[model samples]
Every structure is written in structure tokens, then in C-alpha cells.
Target: MAARTVKRRHVSSRLSCKLFIVFTVSIFCVVVLVTAVRRNVPLDFLWGAFFQNGDVSNFSIYVHSTPGFVLDESTTRSHFFYGRQLTNSIQVLWGESSMIQAERLLLSAALEDPANQRFVLLSDSCVPLYNFSYVYNYIMVSPRSFVDSFLDAKEGRYNPRMSPKIPREKWRKGSQWVTLVRNHAEVIVDDEVIFSVFKRYCKRRPPIDIRKGKLNLKLQKQHNCIPDEHYVQTLLALHGLEGELERRTVTYTLWNQSATKTDNKGWHPITFSYANAGPRKIKEIKDISHVYYETEYRTEWCHSNSTSVPCFLFARKFSRGAAMRLLSDGVIDHFELSALLGNE
Candidate 1:
């Protein structure tokens, strides 16, 4: 009689516990849905792009678009759209500390689910060169991070004003579009000491010249301290996380100067236009065997202080039309998107 009663009680307790979990998850889902409809950009096309060669469940797509829009009407039709958009979305300004803040926001949101192992940050302008499985396996198998971190002391990249707080040896710069591991992501959010200086002192402002009769706007140069580029890279290097640095971006950005108009010059990569797509230009870009670099700029290895890594995986600054052209012109097709998925 005692054994039977005990068994019965255990069964009842297990059932009740499962019921409690299910009820809690149900409420959490409701909250996430309400949050999705509130703020954030509609990543409809970006979502579709990721799943072009594989299922949506394979990856989690998040967009930090400006001019936040209502996602309620859009999410109504689609089940997958539920709880994917992020709340606490930030307004991103070019070459400002806000850029770094927005990145932290994405990291914080994605870090909520421990299932997300590798987090790839991309802009709406960015596109995938390889299909799903290739990207997934490639990033997952790598032991090091794919961030472009290098020291550029001479190019006005390091700020002397930030001296004792941020020492000369610690200043670093690199591409903001990067893939970070969970540990690195946590470091970014939990960081307060280094990030505070950027929020207050180091600012990149617009240039102006208003003479007696002429009103002229000299173009905005690079930020006094590009926090997004500097902060993450410097933190990793300063903390002796140097071995884990891949120092090469998967995204390819053209560094050549444009032939058209020369005004408001900055460190802007050439935006390959869809209009520029031709047999000649297409041939030039297809020769990806050689990596492109600005004639005047170089990022030498700080470890050995000698080597430079090649670009791999994807390219950036390509116009939407240019991306489509790569698809239509058979660059992406030439890579054989289907091989990513084996016969399994």
C-alpha cells in the first residue's frame, strides 16, 4: 500500500511539473510576440535571403534597421516571424559611438538563447556569398574569431587624449562586421570601463567652414575614435586574447578609390553599383583569388608583425542590384550553392 501510494505521488508530481513548465513557456511566448510587434525593422527580405538554400530553423536572423516599423501586420500571416524581432532597438549613427551601442544591443538579445553559438553581424547592405550549410559549418568549426583587428597608430586612429585611460599600446581598429563567440559577446555587454570613455570624450564630428561670404561644408572625416572598430578589437588584444584572433573578415569590401566625383572623402569602400555590372566588371570581381587592399593601407600581423590574411566567405558594400547581378551573372551559382547540403 505504501509503495503504490509513493509511486502514484511521484507520477502526479512529474505531471504537475511539466504542466508548470508548459504554462510558463506559453506565457513567455506571448510576451515575446507582444515585444516583436512594438519596435524594430522588418527584416522580411533578409529573412528570406538566409533561407534561400536551407530551412529557417538552421539560423536565427536579426536585423537592426533604422526607422523602426510595426511588425504586427506582417507577423500575422507567418508563424516563423513570431518572437524573432528584437526589442530595445537603438538608433545607429554613422561613425559614432551609437554604432557600437547598437551592436551591443544585438549581442545582448542574441545572447538570451544559449543555443546561438556563432553570431554574425551584417547590415542590410550585406549579403551572403556562400549558401547556408557552408557558412554554418565554416564558422562553427573555426576555433578563432573572424574580426579585422590591427594597430594603426600613425593614421590618427589612436587618440592621445585618451592616454592614461587607454594606453598607446592598447589602441586598435578593425571592421565592425564580425563573428563572435558567446564568451566574446558577454565581454562586450559586461564591459563598462573602456566603453564609458568612448561615450563621453572620443567623438567624430562634422567639418564646417563658414567664411565672410561663402558657406561651405568640408566633408566629415573619420571618427576621432571609431568605437565600434576600436573597442572590440582593443579589448580582445589587451586581454591577451591574441591567439584567438583570426584578423581577417569573411566579408570582402572593395578599397579602391572611385573615378567619378571626389568630395566628402572618407574611409568609405567603393560601393560596386548594379549599373557597373558588365562582362568586364564581372570578370574583375570574379577573380576573387586575389584579395583587394587600399594601396596606402595595410594591416600587418602584430604577432609576427609580418603576414596578412586573405578575404573569405562573403563580400560587402555591394549594392542590392550588384548582389542580384552576382546571383544572375552566375557568380553565386558558380560556387555551387547545393553542395552545402549533402545527400543526407
Candidate 2:
């Protein structure tokens, strides 16, 4: 009787130890899969509903908002963003290498999650066009990262000085907003050679005033490089990972042609106003099935899981009023439901 009791005790102790080890490993994996972000952007009222019907447990949000900025009931509408900011957030500047630094910081924080399969980079102006489930499934179904890349169009944006670290042949340009798979995200986070070259060589040239002659003659010939625009696309190209990307951005932007024509500075995307944030405009963006790269002379027909699909999952530069207008109108939720039913 004494021997049998001792044997039972020994087996129970071993079973408990095995369970503890498995539990620890499972927690580690969950911590590894949470996603990351950096946002000064206010959450659109509708974005809350985007995840309402979905499995919120599957997605994690990590933010890299402006240093010292807090996301609480006073700052944002959603609890999801609360306490999401990175502790080591840095000040970001437009048209500078710091932009890419901020992106890298966000990516690094997100990569800690072993479960994170996709990493998305967004700007303050961006807004989700579909609900969370649709967007999540859309990205998860495809193996490719959505990286909008093409040949440089604006002359003198590439500095030959960057070669051979960033070869002239590998020099590419694209929108900064991108969705990367874990491997591509790792490549960006782990990159030292290409990012350092960009920090040293890729800089946005100041607007030259030839008439005023305020700029130096040498400066006029300097290449005007925007690091954020080129960094990810060029970095992926340098690593020979272009084939793993969808070669297009999931975020939509409307370049103001009229402003581009009138302003000599350069083109900037138009900010959608409440007046323009209607169901019709949302549908138009959703209807876009392809993107044409004039510089590369290549047309990208958007597809996911070998099924032809609309190009954009998100749209940007929406005013707070425009975002509220989208929510109150129920246009986004309606469209998302429609798409979901269509899929079924």
C-alpha cells in the first residue's frame, strides 16, 4: 500500500511539471504574435465597429505615437488604443530619415509577438475602409506583402552615391504605407546595411529657388530623396525580395493633380472633406481593381487567393469630420457586410 501511494505521487508530480512547461511556452507564443503601430491619428468612430464582430483576441495593437502622448478616454474613442504607445517613441519629421526610423521602431516593437503574421504601417491621416475581419482575412489569405514599388519618376531622386550598398539598378520609389508579412517585416527590422546607407545618403533636397538664387549651385544638382518613400521598397529590392511582395499599397491616396499643376513644390494627396466622404466615394475606391505604374509601365491587377479583388483596404488623409461622416453614414459597415456576403 505504501509503495503504490508513492508511485501515484511521483506520476502526478511529473504530469504537473510537463503542464507547466507547456503553459509557459504557450504564453510566450501569444506574446510573440501581437502586432505593432505608431499613431498620432485619432481613431475614426467607425473603426471601433470594425472589430466588433470579429475575434478581437486574434489581433493585437502596439502604438508608437508622439512621445509623451497618451491614448485614453480623453484622447481616443477606442479602448484598444489605450496603453498601446511605445515607451521609446521618437519625434518624427517629414521628408527626413527619421520617418523611416519611426517606422522601424514600430516594426521592431510589433515583431516581439511570435503570433504576428502581418505588420501594417499607417499615417495619421489614414482610415480603414472595411471592417477589421475583412481587412484581416484579406491580408491573411495572401502570402505577399503589399509594397507599392516602381521605377523612380521624378528626376534626381536617386543618389548614385548610395551605390553599391543601394545599387542604381535596385533604386525604387513607392508610397510609404505598406503591409508586410512577418519575414519581410523581419528583413526591415534586421536591416543595418541598407538603412544606414539611406540615413547617410537619402535626404529630401530643399525646394530650390533658382530665381532667388538663395540655394547654392551645388545644392541644385543634389538628388532630392524622400527616405520614407524609398526605404522599404528599396530595402526589399536590395534583399532581392521583390518577388515576395504584391507590389502595391493597400492604402489609397488621391494625388491632387490640380495642386501638382499649380504648385512647383511637388504633389501632395488631397485631404478628403466631410462633403466628399460619401458612400459614392467609398465605393469608387473599393471599385478600383488595378493600379497602373506609369514609370514601370506595369499594370497591377489586384488579387487575393487567386481571386480578383478590389485594390484598397484603407484610404487616407481624412479629416476628423470626414471620418465621423463616414461612420454616421454607415457606408463603410454596409460595404463591409456586402463584401462579406458576396464572399459567402
Candidate 3:
């Protein structure tokens, strides 16, 4: 009887061990599946040298590429963007409320990591003029945030839609690309009242002729909501925030024209492609050194001033092809990005 009991006990123990192993493996697989996979690295060949010596602990990248962007490591250099992609990205529409939503989503995600001292938003087209460390240290030690918020006398800047909740005086315009400290970033994402008001009234009026697809004449007379530019600027202006707000941008953009599409007035930045990314056109991109500062004019919220730094850390509206052109045409070398990198 004792011998028989011992055999049964041993068999039971073996079965338990096997079940435990299976359970452990199942848990490991689940963790791997659920954990955020975004590595947030840059294109290896392009940015590999940037990160080669820089301490990884100093920065984190979170990208919100448009949905359905496929990744093929062979050509696309997609590995850098891997695991760095945000799953909560929204379809951003031009001059629509959804634009603000996307910005908030990015800010909210970055805020969770306390180590992120400063936040800057960049489109896929944006490329660094300086090395990663230079950009990092420059922002860390800076006294003010860089947002180009101004009041343009141009008709489309301020509308009556924002009245009691957001005074006309408080309404302001700035570049959509912005950088903020932790406090300001938190202030932007946390405010329900201000952003809610901007959402309700800060949208382009529907076209008067829907079937004809023509812009509304009356709508053209009033300001269209570019909330990404207005919301944070207005909030900071209203709260009497300063010093922390420099009202400028580190990202250089050619608001004059787009290479990919021809803006009728030459108001939008040109997108670069092989056809237009040549030296002559690229020279124009390199020459945008003009900077603006706060001014007293009723129409002009910010103006060209002597104090604005000529250092443009990044430039935008570059198509992926444009980025390659920059690399190919020795534009990156001209910017001295290689020489400036990792020096700190």
C-alpha cells in the first residue's frame, strides 16, 4: 500500500510541474503582446550616429504617424519609429477640432513619464538642424517656452465666436509646432473649460455651397479655428503667463510655399520631393533666419526683434524624400549638425 501511494504522489507532482511551466509561458507571451512596442528610435542610418554616444536616459521619442503607415525595415528605415508609435492617434483634419485632440493626446501621453522635462511636437517632415544633445540641453536650460503666438490683423485670425469665455483681446495666433515645460504642458492638457470653449466655437464654418464645394463667403470674413495655434497661447495670455512663455518656435517652417502643392497665395510651407528638392530650392529653406518677438501693435502680437536667436534647431514640411535630399545634397553637413552633435 505504501509503495503504491508513493508512486501516485510522484505522478501528481510531475503533472503539477508541467502545468506550472505552461502557465508561466502563457504569462510571458501575454506581457510581450500587451506591452507598448514602440521603440521611438530614429531611422538607423540617418539618426544612428546621433544616438551613438548620447545617453539614452536623457530623452524619449513618441511618434504619432498617420494610421496605416506600413513598416518595411529593408527600405523605409521604419525600425526607428517602431514601438514609438502612439496607438491613440486620431485622424487630424486641417483647421478642425480634431487637430487639438491629437496635440492633447500626445501631451497627455508624454506627461505620464516624469523624466520628460520639456515637450516639443514635430511632424514626420521635421529634421533636426543640430544634434540631439544640443536640442535637449538648449530646451532644458531655456527660461521661456517657444510658441509663435500673435494677433494678426489679417481677417482670418480672430472671430467673434470666442467672446465671453475667451475674450477677443485674449485670442492669439502662433505656430502650431510648440514646446512647453512640464507645468505649462500640464496646464494645457488639464484645462477642460478653456479647451472645451475653443472646441465649441473654434471651427471653420461649413461651406455655404456644399454641392458646389465653394468656401463660404461669410466664413472667409471671420477667423477659422486653428486651435493648435490659439488654445495654448490664449490660455497663457489670459493667465498672465510670461518668462515661461517666449512666444517663439525652434522648428523652422517655410510658411511661404509648399513644394508638393502650390498654395494660391504662397502661404503654406512647401513639401519636398525629388523634383523640387534641388540645391536652389533647398537654399531658400536654409535662409529662413527671420525671427519674431512680442510687439505693441494692435494687429501684430509678435514682431521681428534683435533678441531672437538665429539658432533653428529643426525645420519642417520636409517630405521623407526631402529628408533624403538633405542627406544627399550635403545640406545636413552645411547645417553643421554632424559637427555640433554630442559635443556637450
Candidate 4:
């Protein structure tokens, strides 16, 4: 009887192990390319490197371009993006509700693939901090999605007019670039109530000069609200999915502190030039282990599967010249090689 029991236990363990492997292999990540133009030059090679040693089936790509633009070989260098543009894409404007519309469209398209267990939103300028395997393992092992959500106290960007449909208490702010799980992505796609309120009330306040000629005095007083910045964060909060998010963005961005809202220059994230896209700058971003949100007084320590990990998986706002430098420097390729050796 004891011998029979031992044999049965061993058989069950082997079966469980095989099932786990199958589950892991079946799961894949969807990279949502949310950009107006074709994919950046370096990203083509960098992403190619990602799948060089792995199965292409383990991941998928979807691009959300403007209405007329297509992501074929004429516009992009890689064959991966050929014919990836969404047929239903609309014209996208900065700081407008249209930006969020593009995101929703991309999510809706990616969700069609049931095998996509994770969804990561990336821009044309965004670059991977680690190799594909590291990023895959980091995102796949986590139980929750990565979203940079925090209280909107400062800036007073939250419009009071949106209250009732979107209460001030539930109004949150964060980076538009986020990595969501399948459930959260579905929530974003299915949402109609909060998104309608945002389109109606939440809009970017026109610049002082532009408002003088194009707007009435009433439009001048409207609160400045960047829809993409607040839409995902607020929508998730409204759904009471706060516990299911990491509350921090994996795509790091450096804002130009000198450019204030009052200045005609306007506020924008700093774009990396070829001079600043060297090894040291990349290392600095990689070294970030925690992020402190001043408004909420919360510090988010990065982790994957309970083990401490770097805060950012990707960094954005790189110019085409800077991106080319990254490829020429072998910076990304080195990481891919190191990641492969580490696994062995």
C-alpha cells in the first residue's frame, strides 16, 4: 500500500509540473504601439532582438496611428509593423480626449487575442531598459498591472463640473503609458460612463495666446485637464480596481521643470538627444528602485514576485538620433546577451 501511494504521488507531481509549463508558455504579452508615425528606428532592431531567441508567438504587436497613416515598409523599417495600423483609428490631438480614444481602440484590438495575458502601452520614443526576457519575466510574474496612480491635489487639473459622474474624490492622475492585465484592459475598453463625462467636461485649457484669437472668454477659465493623463487612472479608480494595480508607471519620463504652464513654451517631457543617450544616463534610469509620490505621500518600492526589481522597464522621449545612438553603442544588445547568460 505504501509503495502504491508513493508511485501515485510522483505521478501527480510530474503532471502538475507539465501543466504549469504549458500555462506559462500559453501566456503572452501584447505590446500596444501608440504613436502617430511609424515605429522608431532603434525600436525595430531592439524588438527584433527580443524575439531573436524566443518564439514570436509569445508576444504580439498592435499600432494605433492617425486615420490616414499606415505602418508598412514605406513608413517603417521593420516588417513587424507592416499593416499593423488599426483600421478604425481616428485623428489624435495632444491633451485631447482623442488621445484616450486611440488607447481604447488599441486595447480593444489587442484583447481579441485571448492568449495576450498582459498589455503594455509604448510610444515611438520608448526604449526597453532590460532585455525582452527580463521584461517578460517581470511583467508575467506579477499579479497586478502597472499604473502610476496618485491623488490630484496640485495643478487643480481636476474639473469640478465632472463631479457626480466622476466625483472629485475618485479623480486620480498618472502617466498615460501603462501596463495592464487582461481584466483591467477589458475594463478600459468597456467603460462608457466615466469616459463620456471626461469628453464632455475634461479638456485641456487652451494656451493664453491661442485662446485670445480662437476662444471666447468663457473658454479661457476652463480648467486644464490632459485627458490621457487622467483617463486610465480615474477610470480604474471608479471601477474600484485600485488594489489590482502597482500605482506606478514602468515607462519613466523626465519632465522639463523649467517650462511652466505660464510660459508659451509650455510643459513637456525632456527629449533625449544623441549626447545624453549614453551608457551613464541609461544606468541612472535602471538604478531607480523606488518612486516617491509627493501628493499622496506614498513611496512605491519596485518588485517582481516579491523580490526587489528596478522601478522602470522602459524610458521614453528619445529622439530618432538618440535612438540610433543606442543601437550603434550596443547598449541594448549588451543587456540582451547578459540576460541570456544569466538565465543559463
Candidate 5:
């Protein structure tokens, strides 16, 4: 009876050990499953979050008139006049819509002027640093206007987003603010294949899958999906406008180390000083001189220009104090605004 009891105890002990092993394995599996589910849950949540707010159906444009101020009345008048001129130009090219609607309007204008010689697009901030005759002469003498850089045909990789019918070589890229020749403008507005692709893919979110799982560094850089940078470059390169571009733009901008933001909010006003010449100020004058001398009144790649126009047609984020310095006849004279305006 004792031997039989010992045998029973041994069997029970073996069974308990096996049961414990099984329980441990089961617990391990559960933990792994839970971790995997938790990881996947965030991706789903992220997708849902982006999708719900990602529909851009209600996006609209807003246009605000510059507020009246007591600075130089002539400068103020020029600013307003330039604004109205831009508004009128858009009106002639396309019908009314919100500020967001301006892109489509521009497309319409492009379509109406396919041969690329009708209008020039300028921003309110751009002041002519050259006289009207110089500008007109430069445009007339140039082999191609600013639009050519944006809309010429050149060899490049094919964009799947664009229609297969349109070859991958006839694209162009440049600043949104440009002097458009009538024919090229028509081509842009009339380009059903390319424009459809652009409109579909050129919004806040690109339809391409290239950026998946990469921490969206591209989005952070430009702060939007299907940023204008990618849109113009890809489209123009695909459409064959690569070689026609003069590789220069007349605008100027300063994005150097000295322009770095001091605040956590990343806002820095433009500062002009007679005693302290910053990078932007120095670069602006240097670029102006280079263009005036080298290109004979033409500038190419004004803004860092690799992605878009290198510099801006006008620099913003200026303090009210800076504006006074900019408006002064002495400073303005030194910068040759008087020569550029000719009649102001």
C-alpha cells in the first residue's frame, strides 16, 4: 500500500510540472499577442484620424486687402495698385473663387495662352529693382520667358501619377509668381492629362505610397502633403521642361544661419541695419549685383532655386521699424529702387 501511494504521488507531481510548463507557454503567447495588437491599434487609429480630417472638400481661399497706414502714401498706393493689378489679372484669366481657387484659375489662364506670351504674375511684395524698359527689353530679348523654365520638355523619370498618355519628358517647374507668356499659359490651362494628375495629387496628401513608414520627414519640411515644391518639380520634369529653364529667377530671399529663429515659435522678422549687415541683406545685394552684371539685367535661380525660385520676389516678416528703413529715400536710393521704378 505504501509503494502504490508513492507511485500515485510521483505521477501527480509529474502532471503538475507539465501543467505549469503549459501555463507558462500560454502566458508568453498571450503577452506577445497583446503587444502586437497594441502596436497595430495605433496604426489603425492614425489612419482613421488622418482620413476623417483629410478630406479637403471644404477648403477655401481668403483674400484680404492691405490695411491703410500712414507711411509713404506713394508706396502705399503702389502696394494697393499692385494688389488690384494681380486681382484683375486673375479675373481676366479665370472667374472668381476663393483664394484656394486661384490655382485652378491660374490653370485656366495657362490653357488660354498656350503659346506662352500674355501675362506675368507678380506678388505684392515684389518691387521692380530695375526700370520698366530694362524689364521689357530683357523679356523681349530672352530666348524664353520665365514660363519656359516652368513648362518646357526635358528627359526625366516618369511619374506614375501623371497620365501614361503624356510622355514623361514634357514637364516644367518654377515659381508660382512668374511672368507667363500667352502660349505657355494656354498650354497649362489646356493640359487635361497633366493638370488632372496635378489636381488629384497636388493637395495636402499625395496619393503616392513612397512616404509610408518613414516618419514623414518630407511633410515636416514643407508642412503639407503634396507640397507645391514636389508638385511643380515632378510635373515639369515629367513633362520635359528641364532644359528650357534658364536656371534662374529674378526674386531674392535670405535663408541663412543669421536668419535662424530665436524663439521656440520659429518666427523671425527681417532686420535692416546700417551698422549690422546680416546674411540676407548681404546676399540680396550680392545677388542683385551678380544678376545685373552677369546676366545683363536677368537673374536666374533667385531663390535657393533648386526646389523653386531661389529667393523670394519679396521678403516678408518685416517689423514696422524695418519698413521705415526700407522706405527711406537714402536707403532706397542705395538699393537702386529709384532707378528700378524709373517713374515713381
Candidate 6:
């Protein structure tokens, strides 16, 4: 009787130990599965949760066409005029909607064509420094992951003019002017959550009516939300696709010139001359080559010693009177025009 009792107790203890091990293994498996699913999910689904019914692949390139209270019909016409000249191999997304709306448009376009290779977003002032063939070949031959590096939060963060509702880990920064891959573009356009968060919290101040002496104190307090930096950065970071960007844009600009002028002022004519080089003049081919080689040319002039320099893919504010001079100066070739226009 004593031996039988001992064997029964041993069996019961062994059964209990087996059950405990099985429970622990099951919980671990569940945790790993959940993490994998979350990481694999598309950003569009997460952000565009509010609007679930749009085709995303119809368009390939996105152009952000907001002429914020400046420039004339000629400038606007120039963009379209030049844009239309490009071959139709690439689909161009153009609209004057708010940043959020523009993103939505991009999302709709992406859904319509998942296989689309490249997306270039441009402003009205932007011109194709190179011909369409060069641009097209650049898009087709470059690695699909070139745009990913720019989208990563680890790369850079946008200035939060207003507090964001989404967590900071999900934020990123890139140029308003960009060339993106189709998948990455879709992620940005389809993001519903990030856009809503920005729209609600990022307030854009209305233009203040300034009278001669009396300041309108009430207008000063109004929060104006400008979507240029924060809008694109936040959405890209959250999607984990930032690593795919090239960390550079192809547009060029001269920001230093634009800064000296007043806001809402008409475009000023900028001439690139050896005389105009200021204190830091590029005197020889070496100097010119050094500046061009060291600097990364995107939509703006960046990586220069002067803060007054304008950083853009295209510089505006040129006096209309100087337009003819600009066209004739042949300065465009100095801007690496040959490289961009290569074989196109």
C-alpha cells in the first residue's frame, strides 16, 4: 500500500511540470507572432484607417503645387509648360490642395499602380535641369531603396511647431520637394492617423493685418500651422521606410539671396557672377569645383557657409525685368546642367 501511494504522487508531480513548460512556450510564441505582424503591416492601413476606400496606384509622381500668396501666372504657367514637355513614361501627380489632401491624392494614385517605380514631387518653380531621358533612366536604374534613407527618423527630425499627437518614434524629416519610390509614396499618401494628428494640432496662423502704428494684438496669438517640414517627416518615420531614401534631393536653390528680402515680396532676380561672390568668392575652377563637389544639390542650396543663401530646388523672387537677362546669361550650364541633362 505504501509503495503504490508513492508512485501515484510521483506521476502527479511529473504531469504538473509538463503542463507548466507547455504554458510558458505557448505564451512566448504568441508574443513573437504579434510583434511580427505589427512590423509587417503597411503604414497606409495604419494612417488611413479613417478612409479605407481609395485606389493608391493610379499615379507615379507627386508635385506639391501650393503657391502661397506669391508669384504670378507666368511662374505657374512655366511649371506646367515645362512639365508637359517631359515624356509621359512617368505619371505626374499635381494638385493645389492642402498638404494632407495632397498626400491623400498620392495615396489614391499609389493604390492604382503598385508597380510604379518613381515619384517626383515638385514645386511650380522647379524645372528639369536634365532632360526626361536622364531623369527617367536615373529613376529606373537606381536601387529601389534609394529614397528610404531620407525617411528614417534616425536620419533627421522635423521641427514640431506644434505638439504632435503621435509618438515621436514615428516622426521623420525630408524635403517638401522629393523623388520617392512608389511603395514609399504610397505609405505617405495613405497615412490617415498621422495626417489627422497634424491637421488637428498643427495650426496655421492667418495673415495678420498690420496697420501703420497700432498692432492687432488678437491676431498675434493665433497659431498658424505650416505643413512643409513636419507633414512629410512624421508620416515617413512611422512607417519604418526612412532607411530606403537616398538622403538627398536633386533640386537646387539659392536661399541666401531670398532671405535678405521681405516676406510676400516679389521674386528677385539672382545673377551668379564672379563679382557677386561676396566675401567668399569662387575665383578659379578649383574654387568652383570645391563648392559644387562638397555641396549636395537638392531643391535648395545647402551646406554653404552663408545662412542668407537660399536653399531650394529652384529660386524665385526674380524681378520680371531681369528675366530676359537670366535666360541669356548661360549660368544654367554652371549648375551642372550637363550632368542632369546627360543622354536625355
**Top candidate by TM-score:** 4
Q: By TM-score, how accurate is candidate 2? A: 0.82
**What's the ranking of the predictions by lDDT, best on top?**
4, 2, 3, 1, 6, 5
Each prediction's Cα RMSD? 15.3, 15.1, 19.1, 11.3, 29.2, 23.2
lDDT of 2 by residue, 1-344 (tens): 00000000001121111100000000100111112233323442455555455555456566555667666765655555556666777776678888787777777776776666667776556677876657766777788888988877456778888887877788888887787778898899899989899889999876656675755566756777889889999889988899888988878888754544336566678999899988888888888888777666677888776778888887877887787777777755653433322232
**Which 10-residue span in candidate 5 carries the lowest summed lDDT?**
20-29
Q: Once model 1 is optimally superposed onto the true structure by TM-score, how far is the C-alpha of residue 138 displaced, in angstroms?
A: 1.4
Which segments of candidate 6 are over 4 A away from where they belong? 1-97, 144-164, 168-174, 211-224, 256-344
Steric overlap count per candidate? 1, 8, 15, 0, 58, 61
- Relative to the true structure, how large is the alpha-carbon lDDT of every model? 0.51, 0.65, 0.52, 0.68, 0.30, 0.32
Estimate, for each residue in 40-98, the C-alpha lDDT of model 1 and write its tens digit: 32222332344455544445545343434334444322233444455566555666787
| Candidate no. 4 TM-score | 0.84
Tens-place lDDT digits, model 5, residues 209-321: 45565644454343122223234344445555545444444434332323332222222233434333434563454344222212122333332223332222233223333
Name the lDDT value of residue 253 in candidate 5: 34
> Model 3 residue 143 lDDT?
48
Cα lDDT of model 6 by residue, 20-74, tens digit: 0000000000000001111111111111111111122211222222222121232
Name the lDDT of candidate 2.
Answer: 0.65
- The numbered model that scores best in lDDT is 4
Comparing 3 with 6 on lDDT, the higher-scoring candidate is: 3
**Residue 332, model 4: Cα distance from true site in angstroms:** 2.0
Please, what's the RMSD in Å of model 4? 11.3
- How big is the positional error of residue 302 in model 2, measured in Å on the Cα after superposition? 0.3
Whole-model lDDT, candidate 3? 0.52
